[model samples]
Every structure is written in C-alpha cells, then in structure tokens.
Target: MSDLLIGGAETSTLAALASPVTVIDSTTSCQDVDELFRADEHLGCLAVHGDGPGRSLGLVSRVPFQHLMSGRLGYGKLLNTRRPVSALTDWSPLVVHAATGVAEVARQVLDRGSSQRFSEVLVADPGAPLRQVSVTDVFRALSGELATKALTDALTGLANRDHFLQRLQQCCTAPDVRRRLALVYVDLDGFKAFNDGHGHGVGDLVLQVVADRLRGCFHPGDLVARLGGDEFAAVVQLPAGVPVGPAARQLGERVRACLSGTISLSSIVLPGRASVGVAVASSVLADGETLLREADLAMYRAKAAGGGRVELVTDVGSTAPREQFAPDRRELQRAVDEGEFLVHYQPIVEVGTGRLASVEALVRWQHPRRGLLAPGAFLGAVADAGFAANLDLHVLEVALAQFSRWQRNLGRAAPRAVNVNVSVQGLLHPRLAPAVLDALSRAGLDPAVLRVELPEAATTTQLDVVRGALGTLRAAGVRLTLDDLGAGASSLHHLTRLTLDGVKIDRRFIAGLLDDERDAAVVVMLLELAHSTGIAVTAEGVETRPQLEALQEMARGRPTFVQGHLISRPVAAEEIALPWSGGLHHLHAHVPGPRSAVPTAPGPVASS
Candidate 1:
C-alpha cells in the first residue's frame, strides 16, 4: 500500500487529483494564467516543469489564475514577486526512505522544525525515482514539534549571559579580519542604594532602565548582556582607528545624563548616577582570558577615575619578564591581601598665598623586602591582584576616617577639602556606594567635603561601566576631579564628557610651566579649557616662586586654583589645624609659634 496520508487525507488527495492537468511553459506569467483562468474556470494552478521548479509543465489549480485575473495579484512573486520555488523548497529538506519507521519520520520532522527553514520532512522511495511517500502530512506533524523547542532566554526574553558570551567568543574567532570587539562592563551605579533605599520593585526598574540604555547602544550586530547583577557587558564591531576613545567617552556621558538628575518613575524620582568601564578589542582577542582581563582592567580604570568616566586598556604586549618577575607579583598580591597597602596624604596649597587647599591621598606598599614601593614599582605585579578592591575600600575608609579626625582635632575644620585617590576597582566594586556611604555615616562627615581625584588616562569614552558606577557616587553629593590633566587625551577629551567639579593639572606641566614656555603653553591651554567649561583648574606640583607666580597670574585672568610644595609639603592630618577664632589671619599670626610651623620663605623669591 502507498504511504497513508493522515489528517487532511481525502481532502488533500481530492485537491491534488481533481486539480487541472495542463502543461504551461516557464515563459507564462500571471497574465498568461489569467487568460487560462478566463478561458477555463476549472484551472487553479499551472505547474511549471522543465529543468527547474519554474518550468511550467502542467496546470494544478484554477484559484491561482483567478488571483491573477482579479488584479489582486501580479506575475508570479516567487520568481520575481517571485520567491524562487527552489528557495521555498528546502534543498536540504529532511527526508526518510520509504521503509523508515513512523517514529523515525516524526523525529526528523521535529528536529528540522526548529531550524531556520523550519522545513517539513518528506518520505520518498530511494530505489525508484524520488516520488513522494508521505507517512504523515507536513503541517500536522511539524506544528507539535515546533511547540516543544524553546526560545533562547527562558527568563528575561533577552539572551542569557552565557549565550551572549558564547556568541561573542564565536564572533572573536570569526574570519572577518576587520571584526572589532568592544566589551562594555556596566555596573549600575548606586543600584544597591536604590534597591535598599526603595524596594526591590524600584531596583528592578533601575535595572530595566539600564537594560534599556544598553539596548539603545546596540548597533546592527552588537550584543548586550546582563552579566547577572548590577554588571552588564556589550560586544560590538567598531570601525578601526575610529577613536573608540571618543565614542567610549560619549557613551559614558550619555549613560550619566540618562541616569542623572530626577529619574521620575511614577513620581518616585530616582536621582542616581552611573559609572562605566569599557575595553575595546580590535581584530580577534588574543584569547578569552585576555579579552576578559582587558575589559576588566578598563572597568577598573574607569572606577578609579571617580566612576562616571571611561577607561581603555591598551593591549600592552607581554613584554614584562613575568618569569623573573613572578616572585614580585606573588609578594605584592600577598601584601595587598594582608592589608599592607598604605595611604599617605600630600597637601595641596594655594601657590602664592601659601595656604593649604587640599590633601592628595597617595598609596604606598610597605613591601618588607623592597622597603617602600610606590604604585610605579609594582603596579604591574599587582595589576591583577585580588585585594585591589579591598585596598581601595580601605583607603577610602581611612581617608574619610582621617578627614573626620582632622575635623575634630582642629579648632576649625581644615581650611581645605581632603582629596582622595580612588581606584576603578573600588568604584565598580559591588560594595562601592555602600562602602562610601558607610564610611561617611560612621565618620559623621558630609560627602561634599571630600574631593575624589581620578587619573586622566581613565576618563575616556570607552569606560561607560565606570561612568555608571561614578554616576551613583555623584548622586550622593560626592565631589569629583579629573586629576593628572594634560597627560593624555583626557585633558581635552573629558572636560566635555564628565560632570566634573574641577581639573587637577598633572605635575609634569605644573612643576615646570612657570619656567618652560612649552609647559606654560600647555598649562595655559588647560587653564583656558577648565575656565571655559566652568570647571575650576587646580595646578599641582608647584614648588618654586616662579611656578607659583605663573599659576597665580594665570588664575588672575581665569579663575584657577593652585596646589604644590610652594605652599606646603605633605603633613600629618593633625598638623594642618585651623584656628577656632578668625580664619586665616589668626592662623597666620600664630604660624611661627609652636601651634603653627609654617616653613620659612627661603631667601628672596627667584624668578623663572
């Protein structure tokens, strides 16, 4: 017996058997079909038979001709309107031989139903020509199969992080030579605070808000994924030498602006900010680990630069002698783990006035064997240190604690803000906002008084993750500065992108700007840039009269601030006490006394 046709059985056979049998050449158009339908009402379709499916060999139905005659249709669409019958007919159509079991036929149809074509399985005789031998009809068999297969992400509707990662890994390894990879690690700034401040419902909204923003950043081929809580990642192929730096900066700024100010979620205005960290991988990443590490490092840099900023991690080749330097890495990581990271404060003073303006908190590692080490000594060694986050938290806590101590001991609050250096790791750490708020709460200090300094290199467009993180911090009334200005693209790049309160001129230019014309030009440009943007410029590392005088002169024209050794050196937080009485005059009058030890002005001021 021939294969049994199931459900539409008799109807399908009658439709196929009763169909008009007339040969029509491939040249026949829908207009030609209209004539046939006009001539004979019984004609429904004229089967084209030749070398391909388009070859009109016979007529099958009159309905298709009617469609042509009524002007409800044009010529055959499959060919031109015209979807190739071959295109509709899946070439790699699932098939089973005539002897195949019914269960096997069902399985093949089920599997193929999930594919792109979603083609139906057909049973055919192999010994003879490829004549149809249907065990079960197409629609009835495949519909149930389609229901069994699932969409990728079961929960969020969006692809899960794992799926996104696998996709990105494949993209990284794709043969496309121009394929550029950028992973933006976005940590919703103050999301925890939002969650804690409001209920989880509000928190979910915040996450959704971030999800929407990430979605907006997507291009045609870009993929954005939420890496579980608070953190999200994006992979994109960007144009080469396209200055992803600026784009990252713009992304950071946009994310900040989007989340900042009053976020009115049904009158519950969520005032928040975000810090973003971004890593760009052009061509293929060296490997998965390197890709992740670079992205992570970039995020850390963003966090370091006071969040709400962008940081890019350039692939510095594996030039470091890791084998020889392996011991240093272990030891440094150990030191960080053991809480051996030390933070020392350096004072920033008004250049000509010689009054303290701020204290810059610097980090030190008391390596037992190395004696003392600045960041330069072991930055690479501790680049991937596990305790980096801990160290930043400790420093922030200590800085705040020390600031509080200074406030209490002195008769008056220190005449300046305490400038603290924050690392990106600390900024994007899950605990960042909470830790900062906790420290402030414990110290009974106002967040406004502290100035967090971020390095120039870290404040780029590519650090949106850091930006979102910083956005959270900024919402809490924390003051931020883009430190080490004039060092990189950040000087010009950040002024427009970040919502910074001030710019700290890096020491390199400020230390010599007064004497070197070239340095002076750079300083002048910075001063102008800051003033134009309404951001106060603070000149750091001024040690001589001429440098101080130049800075003072520059400030005279443009509203600029100055800090350096010219005013005072780093002192114990206790030493720079202000008088309870009148402000600077009282402190100045008692300056030479035991209460105040103002370093004597050395000789006549030397001109640069």
Candidate 2:
C-alpha cells in the first residue's frame, strides 16, 4: 500500500486510514457542498449532522453528489442544484469503530450491499466527527500485512530467508552504482551443544538475544535477517564514495563486539558466541547469490579459526587481517590522558512550568578517528578494561566546572541541580563519593546541587557496595537517583535496601506509553511509588506531543519532570538557556520525523 493510504506503520488500525472530516449542517446547500468538493481533492466525502450538538445525519460522496447535481437534464439540475444535500445523502452508510482492524473493516465493507460496498467507510470515535476512509485503502492495508507475515520470522521478527534474498536481489540488480553492497553473515557457535545441554527452550532464548543484539548494533537503514535456525545475515550499504574495505571492517568490528557478550539467563549465564563473515560486492557488477556464497564461505572459515571474530572477503580475493575488538586497560587510560572525552547535557523540565528543573550531564567520546561516539559504543569496553571509575570521575570533573560556570553566568536562573551518571564500576568503587565531593568543592559548587544517577545494573547486583557509596553521597548533601528504572532484571522491591532521592523512568516505558496499556500502568505505578515516597520523578525519552501529553496527564499533581528530544536533544552545555528562558518556547513538542513515535533507542550517557 502507498503511504497516503496506509499513512504509516500504525496503519493496521482503521484510524490510520481516517482523514479528519468536518460535520456540515444538514441544511447546507448542494451548491456549497459541490464547491467544497471541487476546491479540495481530499474532500472525497463529507458528513451531515442535524440539530443541537449535531448528531450525525448521513454521509455524502463526491461521485453520488455530482450525479445528483447534474441530473438527467438541464431542467432537473436547475431545480435541485441549490437544495440541501442531506435530502440526497445516504443515511444508512456503514459506520465503523476507529479501533477496528483493517482486515476486519475490509471484510465488513465487502459484506455490504454491492451498490454501497465500494463507498467510503464512516469511522466513528468519541468526540471526533465522522471520517471518510476509502474501501480501496482497507484492502490495500490488508494485502500489505498478509504479505508481511509471509516474509517475517515469527520468532525474532527479522526478515525471513525469502524476504532477505528478495531484497538482496533487488539491491544487486539495480546496483545503486553509488553505494557498494556488503553482507555480514553470522552463525552461532556450539548452538547444538548448548541446546542439548540446556534444552531447546534456553536455546531459543539465546537466539532471540542474538537477534536483538544485531538490531542494537546495526543501522536501521541496513537489513538484518534470520536465515533460519542459528544463522542470520545483514546487508550493509557502504556510504557513497567510501571504499568497501575500511567501512566493512569497522562495521564488522563494532557488530562483533555487540554480539560477543554472554547472554544473562535466569540464574545462569550462557556463553553465546558467533562466527561472523563479511563479504563485499562492487556497485557496478554484482550478483546477490554470489555475494551470499562468499559471505557463507567466509563464515565457515571464521568458525574453523575458533569462532567469535569477524572475517571479511572481497571480490578482489583479499581478506582483511583478523583482529579482536577488546579495548585494553592502557588504551582506556590513554584516552583519558589525551583528553578525548566531552559532555552533553539533556535537560529535565518541570511539566507545567516548562522551566528547566535540572540537567543530566552525559559523557561522549570525542574520538579523533570516530567523530562523536555515544556511550553505548564504548562504555562496555570501558567496563571490560576496568576503567569505568576513571571515566566517571573525569566526566564528573568536567560537568562540575561547566555547571559552576553556568551558575556564575546565569546567577539565580541557573538550573537547581546537575545530574551525573555512574557505571557499575564507578558505583561500586570506594573512591567515587570522595571524588565527586572533591570535584564539587574545587568548583565551588554545592554538593546538594549535584545529583548522582545510579544505573539499574549497578544496584541490582552490588547493592551492598552501592549502599556504602549511597550513604556517603547522601550524607554529604548530594542527591542520588535511580536511572533507567525498569531496564534491569532485579525486582524493584529489592531496591528498598538502598537510599534514593528520585528515579528516571526508563525510556522503554515512555516509548510505549500511548500504544501499550501495560506500559501505561507501569508508568502510573512508578509515578505513584515516587509520590508516596516524597521523591522526584523524571520521565525520560518523551518524543511526541501525544506521548508528552500522556505523561503529563498520568503524572498530574505530582512533582514530575520530563526530558527527551521533544524538550531538547542532548546538546553542548553552551546551547541551553539558563532559566530556560520563556520556558523553552523553541523546543516544545517539536518532534523530528515520522519515526519519532518510538525514538531511536537512546544510548544514555555511559550505560555501562
């Protein structure tokens, strides 16, 4: 189906097909209705209403109205041209609930009398006027999804073998000519052994984990799919004018890192590893099947070489050298010494007042070679290298100095507090609290004005160690809050053992606010929990007007703060207006694009 008919991904529902329609008075003349239809092609249909509050009388279609207006002769047209349209309207038009499924709506439309089967459907929702949805749109949406199920994996929801092959052929046949095509093929190692040892149920969970990791590691513009069983593939299009060698190598390295980690299952960790192979095809001359075979063979070579690494093959028959992706302790320390890190601030705004309540200082890697990298790209390596503590302290020092500068410049308008995030190593480190206090002291900033955010992973496992740091920071008048509230595996009930000043409701909850009732209930429960404790609540990752409105409604009368792209994206410290002048008039609910409904999984500052 075309975008105009389906509207967007939410097109499965009848409402996505609905174009807003106004209720015209029953006494509106046919002449006026004709003019309205002639003025706008979108006015394919209109609704008629009668009496006070306007109960729906009937619906009028352009074709039928035109037929009625012209009449059989000029005498008939002259007599009825100025008459009210309601007299000729179809009062018994099919009315459908806005929430009805497209397929079901299509079925209902087909069941109607033959004469009216092709007419527009009148979509009804409370407080909204009847909307005209075309019969053709209903069928088109149905066809698109039935075709989708044929090409999608029911387990991982990635494209199935057939779909992947189909798209690969399309890309190769046309050969973008500007972009080279490359495939990243993956095969799970020891999967059969793991299944026999842990049962297929556990094996299935492991496969799901691999699929999710692939999603996290690849760009959305790329295609990642399951080639059945334990094998998956990704088609990555190289940037225009960029050769396939370095581009494929970097992507392979990054993806390899994301896929190498162990899967944490209930009470047991599974050593889920894979052998990855990347094969490149030139833009000018290519064949999808040949590329697939090359990638597959490279993957076999990788598995033979002991698995868990990325190998690349090109048509030129050259293979990139095999190198591991782990960041060493010395290398991490070198990053610190070289001053290759910077900070971006994401503001938390007061709901109704729109005032910037506080700002979260998120760390970014200003890599000389990699441009600005999100924390997700490097924090895991930092953890592996045992340098999370050093990175945490550096970010703290930089955040404090900038915050002190802001206080000096804005005076009373500066934010009330600044929040800094901590990783597992940092949260458990004995020196974290002292370092924070020292940094605040050096910057002449109040400890109370600094908020330390603890990632969920840090507290779920190392509660006792975290408790000690929590005690020191709390006693020093520094605030402490739990970040990414539902992201970890531990029960929230266990968190009672630690002291917390507030919680940042995870982006997952905020993303699903409008579509999922369970998500909404969880958010409400979290809000109520914070309200009862007399602590603050920060709903993070708000991206749309509907989402913001929903959170505002749910957190009503409570001291809640909202943050995300809709308020202001993570920006350099110099970009925020102190006092958030005029309540950030420039930033209110201005979402970026069609995909803003579910924001790109934000890599929170250092989610190590």
Clashes of each: 55, 0
lDDT of 2 by residue, 1-608 (tens): 00101111232678888887767888998888888988998778887886634345688888887787777875645767678877778877888899987656755664567677778898999898768788767755654554444455656768777678867767765735314778889998888888898887888888888888888787767778889889999887777666668888887788778878888999768776889899887544344777888899989999999998889987522233223236788877787788787787877888766777788888777777667778866786788788888899988988999999889988987888998988878877877778888899999988999988887765445877567777888999999888876554342533455678888887766876786544565577667656666779898888777887787787776778988777766777766655565353344465231122342235443332
> Candidate 1's C-alpha lDDT?
0.54
Clashes of 1: 55
lDDT per residue as tens, model 1, 326-375:
34446655765786766656555553454566677666666676665565
The CA lDDT at 439 in model 1 is: 80
Q: What are the runs in model 1 whose C-alpha is more than 4 Å off?
A: 1-339, 557-559, 571-608
Model 2 misplaced stretches (Cα beyond 4 Å)? 1-318, 321-325, 459-461, 582-608
TM-score of 1: 0.42
Estimate TM-scores for all models: 0.42, 0.50
